[model samples]
Target: MTLHQRPSLQSVPAYKQGKPAAAGASKLSSNESPHSPLPSVLDAISEGLGTIHRYPSIAAPQLTAELAALHQVDPQHITLGAGSVEVAAQLIHAVAAEGDEVMYAWRSFEAYPSLVRIAGATPVEVPLDADSKHDLPAMLAAVTEKTRLIFICNPNNPTGTVVEAKALEDFIAAVPRDVLIVIDEAYVHFDRSAVRADGVELFKNNPNVAVLHTFSKAYGLAGLRIGYAISPLEVAENLRKVAIPFGVSDLAQRAAVASLHAADELSVRINEVVAQRERMYEALEVAGYPVVKSQANFVWINAGDDTLDIEAKLADGGVVVRAFPGDGLRISSGSELDVDRVIAALASVREGAQA
Candidate 1:
């Protein structure tokens, strides 16, 4: 006999991960930090390894304290999880239930819908405007009585477009005070724009808002899966309730603490990545591709109908990039060598199209 499962789950799609590169290919699929962990972070992780036999502290006290101090918030206002993604899932579970609605911009983070579905909450996706930026006006209009939560992926993944500080603040003013708003800032380190929303500062002012951060993207700790959410005490308490026990490993916690202390070093690395991102953006623009201006470490190419074909061409040229079929291509600013490969691949595609 077949085992019973939620019928709605049948429609849920598994998260699509970046494709692996072939031998000698540059992997620009995942928006991972091209650099290795800082030396201090490595040393910290090494020091923590001897205690792996023991269970990791469920509270992750040291890391939590470091983050709290960094954000100038109480420890009670912060909740740690395996990653910001997990923290996001926890947020959904804490406040949402069957029939509740979670709203976010469409063509945003690919994981938003999946997380909403997993929570048994309805996903209300408001489409992005022509510039591939969040249409805050439309999003505000879409908010309904059933809406329990909303996600604003600042420096939104894939597209890498950002909602400016003023626009974001105005949108917050319009949102219902009771509806939970999550600012996913996984790529915040890469964003240097003066007009960018300071999510942490925003959270301090807005009781219903939370800011999500991760070590995965800019911190180069993706493998360790450490992230945290800064929210109001009540919401943070609920988030911690749903978090998996010992979710933030001892090694990850220690490394994250060390990472905080190594801010100068991290700043240098981030500047390098930002520089590379700009270089790639210029290259794409010069190559006549419709690329979105990105504040994240990755750039997006609106390849339109040529997306899949260009992706295949790039793959064959030993440059692997994340392709959304007909939508566009998302290419991470990886190593300098990888950026060269990407530009070369784009040139190849352009030549072939002309032929």
Candidate 2:
């Protein structure tokens, strides 16, 4: 006899990661830092090797304290997870239930719908506006009485588009107090926009608001899988309840703390990534591709029907980018050499069309 699975899972699809690049190809499909780990971070990880047989501190007190000091919040407000994605899942499970609704922007984070569905909650997707930014007004209108949670992916994934600070503030104010709003700022470090919304600042004054951050992106800790959420005390307590025991590894916790201490060194690498992103954006625009000015560590090309073709061309030039079938392509910034390969590939595509 077949094992019975939850009926709600029938509609859920497994999460798809960015496609791995072929040999000799620059892998820009995943938004990851191209830099190697700092010496300090590496040393911290090495130091933790002896403790592998033992369980890590369940509460992750050290990491929690570090993050609290960094964000200038109470340690009680912080909750640790394997990654921000897990923290997000914990948040869903904490607030949402069967027949409850969780809302977020469409084409934002690929994991949002699945996370909501896995919690047996209904998913409500509000379409992004023409500029690919979150349509705060539209999202506000979509909330119903059953809406238990809302996710605002600032500097939204895939598109790398961000909502303005004032607009986000107005939207947060408009959202009903009963509905919890999660400001997922996984890419916040890469954001250099003048009008960026600060999730931590918002969280400080709003009881219903929570901010999600990950060491996976800018910290260059993707492989280590450590992230946290700063939420209200009640929500944080519930997140701890839903979190897998010792999910955050000892090495990950150590690396995260070291990474934080090595921020000055990390900033140099982050600045380089930002430079490459700007260069890629300018080159794509010059090649006649309709690209968005991204504040994150990637550029979004509105390739429309040509999405797949462009993706193939990029691969042909020894570069791989994330493509959303008929929609567009999201190219993560790599080294300067990688940017050269991408521009060269897309330039050839433009020339071929002309021919």
Candidate 3:
């Protein structure tokens, strides 16, 4: 909000993040896991405490190596990020020139257009399909010579439907090689579907693509804010060119490294959430509200009703959910206690529907 801020910065809307509820209010607004950290991750963080006085490795080499190994890619193919959001923003800054256009599906991340405008670029948003799915065909047509960047939010935000893998591959084939395509797979961990786009694999031989992932979702480490990108060596080079050094702190780097090692345990926890998501989806669908097949941990409330009424009723009953101006309501997967509260709130809505 500085007077000297660039005009482009003026119209960029603030990102809306979910906050924890008051002292005792249970929070299910943010799409966060209701689980405790792994003991291994805690030990790593505690060990890192001894090195706080020293500056963190600017490159986050140890963590990068681990990530590369896990992804079966060379270390040069990796670039660490504070979070996948940072990696997404870096794509915009690194590729799009002022006045160039950055395109994405509307109601995607909510951050896409803002970050685009911040880069002194124009945002071309293609509205989602009537069912709230990304209109991939429309997005493909939105690109013009001015388009330098495009973000595909798989299992897209607010609406959890993932673009079919074949459609994604065909879309990539249609896009011009000069433009950088970012596959934001923040929720990949919870995806049990075999048909989802594998961005890392998609970018294997392609330099025009970048795959972003984060520990925030399935890793249950949102508080730590660890994420990374896998891309061609040249793409990684360009990302680092615009990336600020030491972007990730010592503690976060240590925690992420520990997390990669605790993979089996993390998978078990994610599967539990996936199971819960299925049960929630079936319950919602059975109750007569339309529910999309969610590939992520959270489910999208069909937005089929007046979201305001649904939101107000839920809040009054002591459950917190995120309702957009559209009919969409994002209900985070929660602990049994939190989930029960959400179910009770919905039960009232269900009755009102039948009334």
| Candidate number achieving the greatest lDDT relative to the actual structure | 2
Sort all candidates by lDDT, best to worst.
2, 1, 3
Against the unseen true structure, what C-alpha lDDT does each candidate score? 0.91, 0.92, 0.83
Candidate 1 regions exceeding 4 Å error are none
- All candidates: CA RMSD (Å): 0.9, 0.9, 1.8
- Residues forming the 10-long window of minimal summed lDDT in candidate 3: 1-10
Which TM-score value belongs to model 1?
0.98
323-345: candidate 3 lDDT, tens digit per residue = 88556788877766776777778
Q: What TM-score goes with each of the models?
A: 0.98, 0.98, 0.95
lDDT of 3 at 239: 85
Clashing residue pairs for model 3: 303-327
CA lDDT, candidate 2, residue 22: 80
- The Cα error of candidate 3 at residue 325, in Å, is 1.6
Residue runs of model 3 more than 4 Å from their true location after superposition: none
